[model samples]
Target chain A: MSEKLATAPRGKVSLFGVLRSESIRFFSLNSTRILILLAIVLYAAIAAIGTWGIGSLRASMGGMEQMPGMEDLAAPGFASELMGSGLVFSQLILGVLGVLLFSGEFTTGSAVSTFLASPQRLRVLAAKTILITVVTAGVQIVSSLLAFAISKPIADNYQMDLDFGSDAFQRVLWYGALAVAMAALIGLALGMMLRNSAGGITSLAALFFVLPIILSILTSITDWAQHIAKFTPDQLGMALATPSSVVTDLESWQQLLGVAGWIVLPLALGAVLLAKRDIK
Target chain B: MIQAQQLTKKYGGKTVVDNASFTVQQGMVTGFLGPNGAGKSTTMRMIVGLAAPTSGEVLVNGRDFKKSRHPLTEVGTLLEAKSVHKSLTPLAHLRAMAATAGLPVSRVHEVLEVTGLSSVQRKKVGGFSLGMGQRLGIATALLGDPQVLILDEPVNGLDPEGVAWVRNLARQQAAEGKTVFISSHLMSEMAQTADHLIVIGRGRIMADAPISEFIDNGLDQTIVRSADIEVLMNALNGDGVQLRRIDEHGVEVTGPDSVTIGRRALEYGVVLSELRPLQRTLEDAYMELTRDAVEYHSSNVAETGGGK
Candidate 1:
């Protein structure tokens, strides 16, 4: 019996090992695969639809910018911006993925096995952070690339400029990934702090969608509302990813800082709470 | 080995585990016996660093488990059944856990085979029965082959065969010089499995001793039945011995073994019909020890039934 004990070589816990563990479980779930595929397919489909809509509109209004408030859609670079038309949905969808990644541990009581295997609470957090970051960012990048591939031919049919080398399209491809990754990280943090899937995803939705409308209403009434509204996660993500669609005069660095704040603050607070509170 | 020094835990204003202090030595099966809501689970959680101590400390193998370099190899724990995600199959769950500690994939299969879960390794845990979930939990605990094993209510949902298997597993692990700590509310189960018993009640350590000492702590009670009961009572009555008439021809003698009483009856020329000594069962002793410490007291059904 003694010899049968530990027939395999015993190994220690490491950051890389935990990362591997996180990825193994992450990919094994049906929900994760559904969300990733949904994010990519939905993003590309929306982008193609947007491109066709803009192309037909431009063709119908031949030789003249006759429509008021439609000038942005008629612009040459708008086709590139069309590729990122599904950025908001990507954020929410992948954001829910992030929320489930951490919240599932608590909801299913798997945190017991996870932490027992690697007792340092912060290490588990780090591994989860790394996993969500790579997966969400990678998914967003792929989605953006697929959206571009699907939208480019539609733009060419309308003779619109859909240059892959264009600065606006580049921003949509790269910063768009950053924006989705930010939303996903925030979702991960909310999941850790709330420890409930419904509450975390609802809070994430309220942050990304509902809060902006409420803040817009408040901005009409007060000067301070304008300041806070611009820093909302949804607006910051849009302003960084597709600057042509939103009107914002803030410096690029300030918007990046805002994005950084969204990513870092909640996760840091979650780490502190995770270390201080018991795994109940 | 695990050493808990003045370990205490409180939730809100209610104290859960209050001032528990004990040591679980290697090469023995230590039974943490307590009634429901007696802080047995909380203490086990604390031992593995799942729950932080409110004021005191618990050391696993001479240091905090949180700081251990190889956590899986240091302490493998089963906090409760069904701790794995429902959507995950046992194979995926075990693989994920093994990946965390860099253990070989073969170890996962070994545990699955050991726990008789090979047949359903690919099935989602959500579809597993309670007993199967328990087996998976045990399999997870044994995955790391840790020096210390902490199982909380390991036999809660097991069949009789599984229960005996767990008993043998605990004994074999202890025999192999590994520290085995198991928590159960059943004294009868512990009587058959544990060499050392640590009884807890209402978050307090009630008794910690060898299994033999726990059973032998009570005074001897012997039943003596005779045709000449009055003669036996008068002759057997002495200091430190109390006699009670149980029936028309029987007297219960306390503080003397049946052998002593039989000799005394012979000396007094008493014709005895019965000279039986009642054995103190672990269940009775446990009930006696935790009479005041039980969290919930059930009302007498006879009294309650009258109202119904």
Candidate 2:
């Protein structure tokens, strides 16, 4: 019985091995595949319906509205931007996928197996980070492309040009993926920090869904509330992905810096906590 | 070989494993014996780097095990719980663990078969019985074919057959010159499985020695009831012998086997009404060793049947 395995030379735990292990476990779960499918289908369906509804409205009215606070709704980029109408919801679902990636390890007591195999706590964190980043970025990119493909014909029915080469359109396509990716990384960080699935996902929603509303309410009474609102994850995602959605004075570098801050800070903090705490 | 040098662990001013130092020799089964909350689990966790030591270190094969270059090959540890995501099947879980150390899929199958988990390898662990989960945990520990195996409370929820299977497996592994260190609160289980014993209590090492020596240190006691108790007591008195008189007619004699006591009584021509030797079980020795080290000792029952 021992001779069969005794002769096989063993290897030290490598980064590729860790990554492959994470991928295999990640893909085999029913929840992960279901969430990914939900994100893609939800994003595409919302974009298609948004394009059809908006085109029908424009056709019946024979023109677009010209009123106060209607400028964003009537912008030239709005046709291409229709593809990203459901991005916030998609980011929420994909962020949930991200949260589950790390949180599942603790909630199910599998972190013991994972850490005992590698022993270096930081390496496990590194592997999860890479896995979450790669898979979420890949998922977001596909979701965006699927939404765009489904929305294009509807945009053409209204004689509105949703050109792929337009700067605004290209920004919507690429930066929308970036927005979803950032949300996912933040969710991953929260999962590691909180180490509980329901708490992590709820906190994620509170940040993206609830905090944005709270900040908007705060903006009505205080001048500085708007300043803080501009930096919230939702604002950063929307402001970057759909550049014409909200008026802002910050340059592109500052926007990128804000996005980088949202991604790096929580993950860095989570890594430190993970290294110090017991696996249980 | 596994060595812990003054290993200490403190959780918020409460020490869990207090200055424990012991060596688990290769090619033998070393049983970690202790009562509940005696730091047996904590010490095992520290050995595998799952729980950090507040001071000192643990070395596996004469090297620091925390930053081991080849952890899977050096030591395979099943610290506590199922140690697996419940949603995953045993096959997928083992396959993933094997991938971490670059072991072959055939090796995964081998461990599954070794642990008798191949029949239910594809079933989700969430619905697994506790015994099946334990089998999977054992299979995981054997995935890398590690030199050192650490299993904590392996027989907690197993049938008699499963229990005997684990006993045989530990013996088989040790016979093959591998280190098999298992922790259990069951003294009878440890007595049957371990060649060496490291008894711990209240986060401290109560005793560390060979199993035979541990049991022998307690000695056998014989209850001798005789009408001529004074003459028997005088004959049994010696440098190592201890005698305790219970009533006017009974005396407990220790430090010598019962056969010697009976022969001395025969030679002295003392009439014996009763002569019964109390064989010292490992359970008795363990209780004697950790009598003061028990962290939680219940008082006498205040009522029967919950005062119903």
Candidate 3:
């Protein structure tokens, strides 16, 4: 046994190796697979339903020019906007996935194994970040494509334009993926910070859902609140993916900066805490 | 070899591991013996860089383990049973761990076979019994075929056969010049497997020595009972010999073996009904050393007999 151990080939830990490790474990669990499937199905279903709703609304109104206070909904890009109508739900689901990716390690005591193997805590965090990013972005892009595939026929029935080559549709497809990836990364940061699955998920929900409602209420009374509301994760996502659906005065660069903030700040704080605190 | 220099860890205001300094040598199984909450797990965590020490530092193979590039190959640690995701199978967990070190997938299969976890490798860890979980933990630690092995409470829930297997594994690893450091509260287990023993209690190092020296440090104690115990005591009285009266006819003899006492008794023609040697077990020595250091002493158990 000793001789066998001595002769066995040993390997070193590299960033690429840890990333592979994260992916291996990430793909092995039933939760990950279920979450991804649920996100895709729910996202596509919402988008398809949205396309039918808009098409039926426009058909009943006689024509796009007949709609009076809903000009944004009658725009040529509205059909594409329907493809990302479920972006919020997709964000929540994939964000929860991100939270679990990190929180599960601590909640299940697997951080002991992970950290012991790699030692450098930041490397593990970086690997998880990359894994979740690729995964959420990939899942979001697939969901958007599936939504488009199902919604195109519904839009055609109502003579609504759902052209795949339109700039607005491309934005919804690509930026929608970016929006979901952003939420997932935020969830990842919360997971690393809280180290509890429930707490991380709750925090992610509050950031995406509750906080936006609260900010909207505060925006009515306060000028600062209005400015902050434009930078809220929900608004930032909508502004980037379907800008016509959510009116905002900020330029594209400014909206992109806001998205970067949502992605970077929480992760930076989480990485700091993860590196400084004990794993137990 | 692992060296800890004044390693200390404090949780909030309470010091869990207080300034402990000890070295675990290679080529021998070193046992870390302590009661529950004695900071054995915390110390092991600190050694592998899981838990950061409040003060001081620990080095594995002469460098900080936190900075180790080839961590798995340098030191393999099993801090707790089931340090794994419940949703994962043993095969998945091992493969993931092995991937971190770029180790071959075959090594994962090898460790599973060695730990006797091949049959349940595909089973989810959530349903595993405590013993099975422990086996999985051991399998993970051996995944790297590491040069240094640190296992805490390795036999907490193992069967007799499993326990024996771990004992043999530790010995075999040490024989191959690998550093084997195991922590346990079971003194009997340590007595059989460890060549060197480091005893800790209440977060303090109580004793560090060889297994032989640990049991042999105390003087020889023998309990002699006879109607003519007075004659035996008188005959055995000499340099390094101390005799204490247990009863009117019984005397506890110290500093001489039973054979010597028998010889002296024969010379004195003493009629002795009992000449029993009181052997100092590892348990007794450990209890003696950590008498005042037990964190949560069992009031009923400690108060009843001799107050262990």
Candidate 4:
């Protein structure tokens, strides 16, 4: 039993304070550390193996100089780019990390603590959004850089040019990181909306994995399916990362709008549900 | 002080709490007594703005809680047990909550110690026993040293010692002039801890008065046996008085104190063999109030009633 005291000063909730709290909770978990480690290790390992396999193939094809388009296949720094071949897996892993960031609150009944501490529920949502975005972006960038540094020499051994400053290379680095951020944001939104780990993760997998394959098959049958497929987050993110390979039908502004829709719609819906529903 | 006016909450066509209204005063532990599903938790949630009232409003310190900027400092609540993350230790959870109000981390440790959670402060809440979880919940409620304290089922999982501890804590808080509001199903606990009682049944207030007044307002009966039972029964009848014959030499008198019955019997020249006033426990009072309101009333009510 404690005595009643004078009312405490209720200052406006600063985003920085909320972010700090999110960071503390995020780093406190063993799962977060494990996910980040797995993302980096898996990315580097996939890159190394792809580089070795591609290098051996090029060596074997060296004597067939007359093969049309074979030289393009041996393009310089291909092996270096191969090092980041596991970006898709990285996205999935880190995206789930984002999903767990919010879903775990509900699953573990910690949303009560979170919302009670900052009753402006949307502020907590915004804070978590910012945290997942920054952390996912940071991890993606660092994982890509590590993979590139390790695979550069392997590409050079095969006499491939590995320029770090090329526009294509930078696109793969920066936009690839952005793609990871997008995936994480989408995952976070789904997590908040679903508020269950399996439901959120399954929905994310369907969006990124199953739906894209289904759309690819659908495109073979109809023109309208191709138009819809071009706007999917999977296509948009892939086009944004590998500019030379995945040519998107969307203009720059259209792609930006698609990304915005992907991020904003689910998050807005999740926030509304969170504000309206009971914490239990 | 906490004032709830016409507070109502409806979920999908069912009204959980129906226009409940009551004012809880300071310097006393007011017990919120209700049968299961009587909307005690809903009322507590509405007070803190956790669950919105469909109609009406609840005010803390003369203002709506939602509009109050300094809510945590104004009112501390333990709404439910284990409303914490499983992965988070009590230390991290409390520190995070304390940081919201810019309160010192030192206060977190202080509350942990106060709630007897110092030993388990570093343990993850997932590993905590129910009693430990309750302690952590209480520690969180006490973090802000609030003017108004609202606890729903504070002693639900406590052992006997923990129960006594909660009783002391409630009394000590009230002695310091804070408005302490606690809800529980345990009538004996409420009887020992609450100075004022507000009994609710079926989302409505059944009785609101001092603990003693609730006990005294209902009924008082005494059983008397004498060689001249017929004489005793005649002597005890008047305004606000009634009598019922028990057997050959026994009678039960209602609406008269034991002293008055004994004095009357002596004045009427009846030698009483046995005279005793049946004490009414708080459990009896609660049962009388919630007899119709209990969701599952036992068939033995008649048998229990006859014995009492």
DockQ of each: 0.64, 0.60, 0.69, 0.42
- What lDDT score goes with residue B252 in model 4? 79
| Residue-by-residue lDDT tens digits, candidate 2, A1-280 | 1223443457679888888899889998999999999999998898889888888887887656565655565677887877777778878998999899999999999999999888888888888888887887788778878887888888898887677778777777788888888889999999999999999999999999899899899999999998888888878777887777655777889889999999999999999999899888
**Candidate 3, superposed: residue stretches over 4 Å from native:** A1-6, B225-228, B247-249, B301-308
lDDT of 1 by residue, B1-308 (tens): 99999999999999999999999999999999999999999999999888999989999889999999888888878888899999999999999999998999999999998999998999999999889999999999999888999999999889998999999999999998999999999999999999999999999999999999987989999999999999989887889999999999998899989999899888989989999999999999999999999999888989789674
Cα RMSD to native, each candidate?
1.8, 2.5, 2.5, 3.6
Off by over 4 Å in 4: A1-13, A63-66, B297-308
Best by TM-score: 1
Question: TM-score of each candidate?
Answer: 0.97, 0.94, 0.96, 0.93
User: Model 2 residue B259 lDDT?
Assistant: 90
Docking class of 4: acceptable
Q: Is candidate 1 or candidate 2 better by TM-score?
A: 1
| Model 1: DockQ vs. true structure | 0.64
lDDT of 2 by residue, B162-268 (tens): 88888888898898899999999889999999999999999999989999997777678899999999998998899899999989999988888889999999999
Judged by DockQ, which candidate is best?
Answer: 3
- Model 2 lDDT at residue A48: 86
> Against the true structure, whose lDDT is highest?
1
lDDT of 3 at B94: 94
Which portion of correct inter-chain contacts appears in model 1?
0.74
- Considering DockQ, which of the candidate structures 2 and 3 is the better prediction for this target? 3
